[model samples]
Target: MAFAVTSSTAIRSSLSTPLEQPKAAQVGAFQPSDRHHLPPAAVNFSRRRCAVKPLNAEPKRNDSIVPSAATFFASEVVEKIDVEDYGKLAKDLGNASPLEIMDKALEKFGNDIAIAFSGAEDVALIEYASLTGRPFRVFSLDTGRLNPETYRFFDEVEKHYKIRIEYMFPDASEVQDLVRNKGLFSFYEDGHQECCRVRKVRPLRRALKGLRAWITGQRKDQSPGTRSEVPVVQVDPVFEGLDGGIGSLVKWNPVANVKGTDVWSFLRAMNVPVNWLHAKGYISIGCEPCTRAVLPGQHEREGRWWWEDAKAKECGLHKGNIKEQNSNGGVHANATVQEADLFNTNCVVNLSRPGIENLLKLKSRNEPWLVVLYAPWCRFCQGMEQSYVEVAEKLTGSGVKIAKFRADGEEKPFAQQELQLGSFPTILFFPKNSSRPVKLSI
Candidate 1:
């Protein structure tokens, strides 16, 4: 909702340079733009290009209860809200309340986490913390190009709270040079994402570093695209690298359970810091240049980048992250392997002691055994290790046994014979009577 500016030098060292440009068709082939100042070694050749998606889809089902102006502020959680549901939404704020949701969220998340305060829902969060006698860290991204109103709110919040808000600014010199050459509004004419790359997205990646978990103002009533079932606490892959490669372990959205009218009621009741622009009917806020007023029937996100093609409403944050992470060629972060009996035929068992009776054991036991070949070093393989271990444990009580074979390093002869049969993390299911195994690639 808002960006905070801080001293520049510290900002530069704290941030990882963003990827150069979007990737083309070739897998694992991408050029790093001069957007951020990432080192060459950290370039991550395996990182794939991420595609951006619009934010105006029906809010994720998980966010169905988010209060919005269109809903007339009802707090009811509808079971089947669709794009058409917007037309039938109530405009009153009787049931949908922000304060009630904040109370519930605080009780659940505790003081161990912070929220993504961008000055929009930020006012409510700040006031709620003060009123409830709960102290929490206030964090926000400082994209060098923030609106003046947001800064005023920042100062006001600090004065009211008697605490310094953590300011996450962009690299000073990098922003200066990029803005100088490209011009301040280049992103408006060319692509807003480019501007976001240099400001919001990259800076956010840096600011999120070292946080154990965080809270966001995201709600379901905002868009159809986010309407999926929302989870109170979930792993956010976007910030996975925040703390030494593996990022924040948890993300909480307490407002995910709250809707719109509730926010205004609390603001009035608590006399929270209200933004001047909101008085002019701006329900949501972002960069002033890119954001506009939403008409009565328009989607909540219709105001964002209104000049762009309707289908291209979103900036680079959400879309790019999902695209790059889903692709097989992309960096492996979240991976899971599920194994099941591929064939009806009973499989043979193969038993052997590492040092002795290899041939004799194989000859004596007619049934073949299932073996999972994996490399511990491979990131993808690492994700599957737990699943394989679970299978090994499950099969222990049953007559079927599971065997683990390292694809590389040790047991060269055995590795070459069974483990080396395919790429790392490959599963081989051998039938009860057959010597040959079926390769399972997931």
Candidate 2:
């Protein structure tokens, strides 16, 4: 039977039932009767600090799809995805739906790839993978400091899924050394990076080394400053997999384009068991000491490392998101002008050359656009990124569409000729009536 967290509301309300191992039968890995006998998620939750969002009160298992269980027990050896084509593949799957992306990753890598499940909403990865009816593996980090609710939720997931989750933990010696020297809460004084490297990143590194690829639940909306450019697929720039080296590991972010609200919607609609912490305003739940509840109007990530810079909150897990500011104290894009944009934000519309032209063509449709033509590497453009995003955020309910267009590299000539782009950062206002875009002085 297909086993994924996103497919059922049959959470074992009580921890009384012994964890049952997958029962291999004549047909496949498990008997359909095995699921029918399990308990439902009727546990009484304590009142929360914040208003609790009710789970799918009805059982979703009745409608849940169960594919070939035979695919669940054993995995056949499959050819690994070619890491060299990750760039091209990324563009190809950039707009693919989350289920489509998950299916491709599971089908290509099979058991060689593992779904990285945090005790949080990432369980949706497993939910989608199981729908593909392919054999897949899963792993998670035991930071040893997670919330009690998280651990209980992990056990509940394992029990309900009828599968084992390979758990990784930080090296005992390394953890002891750090604790013995720095005491228990040094992150508050120094930073969270070092502690996270020991508890989370290192353990993850060890886990990835055993697989050819891994699937993450990362969405572009998670950490806008760091993850805004996250593609659906890519070659892992930091961690290596089974073959052991850079470019050996392929990374699949099945939900790269999915929104946070939509993820919860999927989980709820499917009747998936969610961590109890989410109801307490802990939108970005992590290790207890380092994580707190997010206040009203705050981003989910603000709960993590609240003392640190919003842009530099990554815990070394995804090194690609790490940024090093240039001497001018502005973001310095990479060598490529187009791929490297002046700023990263989900608020503004990032239009390609063709997209800009298409917007211009829609003038008769009464659509307005405030497009910024800028070079990614220009200091002035980089400096204005903050203000630009602020404007976009403020004008969200307004009719104006704030956008960015890279007016550098091969596209520079086209931008200058058609859009009247003359400077490093040119603001062009396209009104509803006229097709001609008027240049604005900013």
Candidate 3:
């Protein structure tokens, strides 16, 4: 018999108050929500209803179906799938709504399919999956550097959805090794690829080791240059798994055709818990150190690794390859140096070795200046470019010179030694006649 699943009742019935919020002590102290003061808005869900036949009620057919992992006693046999079949299926469902695509996926893969929840689009996927009244799995990559608000949103999602989210973390030893050798923020000096590989890619690989298929919230419009051809379903070329063995896995992008506005509309309409940072202009959320809110009229990708070119926006999680062409003839060989002279100028100056002497002369005049040490490849720095420029324009009359230095280029040593930089896009305030520079919080 077909069952009617009202979104409100289904969500309310499934959601019981979490016994306790998950502790994030190892990462950082992030309070999810106060027990007495949990905002109703965060948990409010849409009342829209739909009808779906439960998998158990449907007649058993020849289609290969993996039993839910929750049924531990069931057979652990892996299902063999033809790649050609999924390619055809992707084409058929290419124009389907996100919910319809999700329903088809859950029916086929059962618990073997898992949602790779990042923040926005993933949550919308979860809302649709939950409405189906079928058991499914969800996982997230807890890159050690996620914002505290992201952690809070994670908890809120769990409490509202009534599901346990498997958070995959980088191996402790691997993280320790990377941090020990390269320092806390090595991505600023060498580029973000290496750090992302250690913190995000490896952990995600481990997480997908057991799943047969995975889903993401990638949209074609998000990165037209890189993700323009994203299909609703395709074989993941990079990672492997299906029944916990090494093999190509089905990858689903149910919302690939949906716009960002549509995702936000669903979130608001469904009252799905979302990362609070979104309200502050952070469209695409990732590691705290790497992400920032974009200015008005900026693209979402700009909020991510902004220092890189448009085609290189991916962090090897989706696209799988992180290698960049070393075609520069080693011009960036001194890229690792951390000490250099700062340039002085009246207006917004791009500081470098040639201008260092002039900067010193300006320093002697006792004028306060705001200096930004940034990497050209850092996405966060790129997102803040317009705002910083505006700040400089406004401060021009106050005798305050806004200046910047490229830490990833010729002035790397200057940023490393003089700034004592820990992360990319470091900003400092030098007061008149003071030998010390106060690090300004971004």
Candidate 4:
């Protein structure tokens, strides 16, 4: 059993020609029942052929690998099936053709579901929906900071699918408070974790409150951060509140193993619309001001927040549940905790000379300089680093005098008492002779 959208005859027909394989009826001549299962050698040969292209149809390709339906089915088998069926299913799957596996998963997940669209490779998921006639709930986060191009893509997807996409917004009050106090790009200045808690995680938690499952357009190929073996039905802890208190929400990554190039080809063939930002080389689309196109041979997410010092590349939505019941009192909401009470701290290894501080203090004497405070282990911090780097590069040798500080240990006490900083990467502009910092909007 696996979670997947079942394809209909019409959908199959639309894709049949591209497959350029013998007709199903003609191919059926070689069909084997229980015994029809090919021997291990034959299995390898048929799998190799199927891997190159769909056995019943021609394969639509992209960059990394041409995804045969086999991989998707293989990826979902564990998450969607009973333990008893797993061994036989795994053996059968290792031998059975790709087409059969895909058919089985789709049958198990059903067609009615929501596809989480971020205006990225999500289009491929949409293409699958269109080709399969599996109606899906397409949704996007109106983070209010998204680029105009993303909004335009939303409109385009509507026209292309002839369906209404659900819109999710962050809590108005929370957003207002966070933005008003921290500024728009606060995520960059204040550190990504808190910013995501306000902008992405909270909103996403609220948005997914009622849904049983969500289909993300995310692929393992996106980055090292998302490299875990994705399961089709895993509980999402962040949205635990969505469960109305118990076993609230489960996530299914239908495109978990989908490659970027495959998504692009699918989009092209389906005449699927895309945002103009992509043409500018923006592969992973999100908040416009926060994202950029990657250079050749670069990681797909390398262009994002290119100016930051940390490596957290996620926006919080993709992070597994971070909430933990605290013995002290409130719940601790870190997605990954190595050990209890041992919150992964992000600190800078300062090998720089102490004279640097005097220079920084001297520079802060002229104009308000925006400095970002952060840690290395935070994913949100990692995600925003690319954008920060770009910002720093643009302002380099300029009068702004950009600087960074790690908020831990002795520096933590100084940061709290002197700067009144409560979050990581607090982007504050230090004005001359002033105790108060003029906070700049990210």
Give one digit per residue, the lDDT tens place, for model 3 in 1-442: 0011122321221122323333311111111111121111211211212222223322222112222221111112223332356668888998899999887776666556788888654688888776665555677877888887878787787666655566677778868967997899887766786678668866776566555578888888887645656778865654655332223466888999999988888877876667778778999888888888999999998999777656556776775212222456222221211122222123477766555435544544446667787764443453344346546644656666678876765667766776767676787766666666777666
Q: Write the per-residue lDDT of candidate 2 for residues 9-58, one digit (tens) a residue.
A: 21110123333334322212322221111121111111111111222222
- Specify the highest-lDDT model's number: 2
> What would the TM-scores of all predictions be?
0.49, 0.59, 0.56, 0.51
Q: Which stretches of candidate 4 lie over 4 Å from their true place?
A: 1-112, 241-246, 321-442
Encode model 4's per-residue lDDT on 319-403: one tens digit a residue: 5533333357444343343221111112212212253255345633654355565554444443344345435444545445455
Candidate 4's displacement at residue 135, Å, is: 2.9
Ranking by lDDT: 2, 3, 4, 1
C-alpha local distance difference test of each model: 0.46, 0.66, 0.60, 0.48
Which window of 10 residues has the lowest lDDT sum in candidate 1? 63-72
Candidate 2 minimal-lDDT segment of 10 residues: 1-10
TM-score of 2: 0.59
Alpha-carbon lDDT of model 3: 0.60
RMSDs, each prediction? 21.2, 21.3, 20.5, 18.7
lDDT winner, 1 or 2 = 2
